[model samples]
Target: MNKVLFFAHLRDAVGEESLEVEAGGKTVAELKAELAGKYDLPRLETVMTAINEEFAANDEVIQDGDVIAFIPPVSGG
Candidate 1:
């Protein structure tokens, strides 16, 4: 299973901070697409994704057992 993390508004939107699923080693875009479909998160387009703490492109493939984090832009004091 692949481990995925979430932060800020993204977590609140989904009402779940994290999730794990058995998926293939597809690109980040593929993963995002699947998740978006499942969660119905229309704002996913505005969110940023990372793998192993490194900002990554949508086409970046996610390896098995990877730690992928979803972080939305945050504005605060």
Candidate 2:
């Protein structure tokens, strides 16, 4: 299982700071699509993804025990 973390509005969307998923062998984009559909999340294409605290590309493959975090775009004046 992989630990998926949500930030900002993404966290609110998931209603939790983090959740575990059976994501090993899946790409970041694949997981994002699954979560978006499952949770009805929005604008996931614009969200940044991080694996094990380091920024990752959509094609990056997830591994068992990896920690994934999805962070939405932040705007401020």
Candidate 3:
């Protein structure tokens, strides 16, 4: 299972700070689509994903046991 981390508003929306998923062999975007269906995340388009510490495109393939993070841009610096 691959591990996923959610930060800020994403964590609240997903109802967890982190979770595990069988996301290997899938593009980040595909995985997001799956999760959107599973979690009923209708606003998923507003979120950003990261592989390791770098921003990742939806088409970017995720590695087995990769560190994936879901972060939503928060206003107010």
Candidate 4:
């Protein structure tokens, strides 16, 4: 299982800061698809992804115990 973290408005949308998902051997893109479908979140496409505290590519494979964080775009003045 992978630990998926949602930050900013994403956490509010999902109603949770983190969730555990079975995504071992799946790519980040696949996980995104899963989340979008499950949560009805279309904005997920614009979020940045990190795996285990390091930025990860969409094609990066997920492993068990990995921490996946979805960071929504932020705006500042």
Q: Is 1 or 2 the stronger prediction by TM-score?
A: 2
**Residue-wise lDDT of candidate 1 within 1-77, one digit each (tens)?**
78889888778777897899765589888889888888877688888898888898998888888888987876778
Q: In model 3, where do residues sit more than 4 Å from their true spots?
A: none
Ranking by TM-score: 2, 4, 3, 1
For model 4, give the 10-residue run with minimal summed lDDT: 37-46
User: Which pairs clash (backbone N, Cα, C closer than 3 Å) in model 1?
Assistant: none
Clashing pairs in 4: none
Question: Against the true structure, whose TM-score is highest?
Answer: 2
Candidate 3 accuracy as TM-score: 0.87
Give the poorly placed runs of model 4, Cα more than 4 Å off.
none
Per-residue lDDT for 41 in model 1?
Answer: 72
**Candidate 3: residue 18 Cα off by (Å):** 0.6
lDDT of 3 by residue, 1-76 (tens): 8899987766777899888998889999999998888877657788889988789998999989898988787676
Most lDDT-accurate candidate: 2
Each candidate's TM vs. the true structure? 0.87, 0.93, 0.87, 0.91
For lDDT, candidate 2 versus 3, the one ahead is 2
Question: Candidate 4 — what's its lDDT?
Answer: 0.89
Model 4 lDDT per residue over 2-52, tens place: 899998788888999899999899999999999998988757778989999
